[model samples]
Target chain A: MKDIIIRGATIRRELFFFLLSFIIAFGMNLYAIITFKTLWAELLTQLPFLILVTLVIYLIILLARIVFLGINKLLRIKKNKSSV
Target chain B: MNSPYKSRRAFIKKTIIGSTVLMSYPWLEALANESAISMSAANKVRVGIIGTGSRGQGLLYNLLAIETSHNIEIAAICDNYEPNYQKAIELTHGKAKAFYDYRELLDIKDIDAIVIATPLHQHAHIAIDAMNADKQVFCEKSMARTLADTKRMANTHYETGKILQIGHQRLFDKKYLDAIDYVRSGKIGNVTQIRAYWHRNNDWRRPVPEGKPELERKINWRLYKEYSCGLMTELASHQIQVANWVKDAQAVSVIGVGGINYWKDGREVYDNVALIYSYADGTQFIYDSMTSNRFYGLEEQILGDKGTFELEQNKMYSENPPQPAGILQLVNNIEKNIFEKIPIGGATWIPETALEYKGEYITGDFDVNETGISLEVFVDSVRRGKPTPGLFEQGYHASVWTLLGQQAMETQQKIYLPEELKI
Candidate 1:
């Protein structure tokens, strides 16, 4: 049951990051369309570009998450040594 | 044996030339005439300009631009105002004979045609005199200040048998011509309504040269009732002409309301106006002009049953727009080896409102100088010794209807076009 809870939480965290990345990609595309005075309907035609941008953002987030976890682990080790 | 490459090349060249000729306006047909191309002193059309104000100078610039290509000459120029007269003489590099009075300029028998760019009230008089003097007249738009003068001008054109081309430049614009063609070809499926507006945020006033209070009326004649019909004739006339041309019918009646809601600087004309002109076929041309807000700068929104044309923007929106090929759609087609609709956006993703479809351009090449084209065509007509068919009637009706709209606003009643006014 504990393993199941951890797996579910992991999935939720991944889903959150993916959704954030997608929203950012959508916003950037929307801004570009508006700036160019193009139709809002262009968003549908730019599906591939949107998906590519979202994946690129997600990869960057994932890399940042790993770096943040590593930094947190190092900080915790330093705190324990100081407490000792 | 016949060379296939040569035949193919010949065929392509012929097709291009044929399509260009087909797309061109009827008056522009003169450009292809052999007589028009042969440039000589005898064939050159000598043009006299009666007004050297802003509009007159604009026409002069266009004429100068096309002088060499069209075999035209600025024979003489006349203006009562000192500044404009001096400026016009400088524009022609002292080539055109300058005159203080228009009659003296008209007296020059060698001047084949005269362009009238004077104030609204002066159009009929100058045009009539020029035509009577045996010179073809190319007068600026909104034919005249009064309906009687407008009618008289048309009558003079008819009686003299001289070319009287009005400055409705849209008739010569390729975008307008293409859009109108679409309307006529049932591409738009019967235009139901047309909404046109011209808006600006300026006070519509010109400077009076500091202490020269007397020159206000002379310089800014458009603001006064005696010299102009204000926005109706100055701005609305062009759009009304477009609406009439699109419907191929004049406004049978008009009901309007106007007031000096803003810019209350003792100007006789209204600062804002809203008018609805009804056609015989139940079509309505909704028109308005204002000098207070300019959010919607200007456009002729021609709405039909199947489509809509925003002429100023050069776009046409269809009721049933074609779906463009997206990446997912292309991938789906390749995977399935067949084309089929795929529901990409699910129920939650679907938009609540109607889809905002971006319409296609009316034509790719739309950066045309319509004023130049109109003047070139007018010069051609003068050379041909004939007026362009239907051009005079279009200008006449636009002016008459514009005056009728003014009357409606003044009386606060639906004004119908009188039988006698329907030339």
Candidate 2:
């Protein structure tokens, strides 16, 4: 087996993808919180709660990435088998 | 060993003080473990109710009936109308907080779910808002006033991935389930047609107070086009839902004829309607509703080549006559004098009597009410964080076709449901 390493360009592309994902996840949750009229003065004062929300969203995005990559690999294998 | 009820009660008491206290109560812990009672006080699903009219109140009663079994509490109730709001509050024993506006009720954080029993037009807005609030929704049937609103509600359900249960109680009805099974199992032999009708003689109106003539339309919303589609949404929706369920498909097209033949006193909606919806498989559902006559009140007949079943009557009639019972056979033989030596028994000696076919009972004693069972299912789904499958689509199809039928009636032409609206 050959040693594998990710290139700088590949790492940059991955970072861009993660940044976009984070924006989408956080924006959606924030929009939901505002829509439900849950952004009270008391709740807004709590920094830990906001941080926890952000962390949960990050975890969700990470899980989604794993699931999507797994599905992509499965699809590629299926395509190869069909070609064979 | 203590009874399940006793154990559950004791567990509730111990868990209420604290989990530490519950751990110390070894008997309660053992009872809870033995009974598999996993729910604690925090796990109880809090429900907010919108619209406390007759239908909404009935649903509240059903919810209350199943509260103990399902671990649900009516946290809040909302109705703009003062009388209804007060009545609903009283019904809840003043346990639930009452709100004049639904939005105020929706603002509460502890409410895990919302039951929307508002008029037809308000369903989409409230349901979409509830889902946006990250609350599971159980909206009453005739999902929305327009095809566009119906589509939006359905799409929102998909986008949110929250449990959206529409108020189609027939879906949870054991009798209807058994009937569907019988129809699908070839007992009815390919249901070719369904005839459904709801008839009443009285004016479909709630009496308004003498001082408040301006509130006439508001009080009797069913008679107005702005708030409701009259009998189509109020009555025919139930039968149409059953038809769609039995066929296992929605109508492709519809044609209808309706008019204000009776009760035309400032009413916007037609008093009589006759519509036919054609399914993809060529099965037709013939529907009619009238306020002029109350005779033959309401029923749905599922007709096939071999047999026909009247769902409301709970009776099944077969095309081929059934064999007579042993006593009846003996009686027939005695009447015909077949056992005795027949003096001049001819080939066509004259039929003794015309064969009569009285149908047999198909439904048994169902102790559980349909609405109660449906509420139980809805609460269970909300608690489990998953909707009862296929319920949303059933409601959507029924509502779409109902509106399509209304459109056909209004346009005076055949109406085909647009492809986009099919889902």
Per DockQ, the best of the predicted structures is 1
Off by over 4 Å in 1: A1-84, B1-25, B28-36, B324-355
For B343-370, candidate 1 gives per-residue lDDT tens digits of 7776757467955788989877666677
Q: Rate the local accuracy (lDDT) of all candidates.
A: 0.86, 0.78
Task: In model 1, state the lDDT of residue B385.
Answer: 92
DockQ of 2: 0.00
Separate DockQ for every predicted complex: 0.06, 0.00
Chain A fold similarity by TM-score, each prediction:
0.86, 0.53
Native contacts, share recovered per candidate = 0.04, 0.00
**Residue-wise C-alpha lDDT for candidate 2, range B1-423, written one tens digit per residue:** 333334334434333234443333232233234333346797798999999999999999888866766677999999988888999999999999899988888899889999999878899999999999889999998788888999999999999988787888766444565566678677878799999999999997798889999888778888889988898988888898999888877888899999898786989998999999999999999999999999899999999998888888777888786754332343355457856665675675666773477887765743336666566556666766866556678888888888888999999999997989966
Q: What residue pairs clash in candidate 1, if any at all?
A: none
Off by over 4 Å in 2: A1-84, B1-37, B325-356
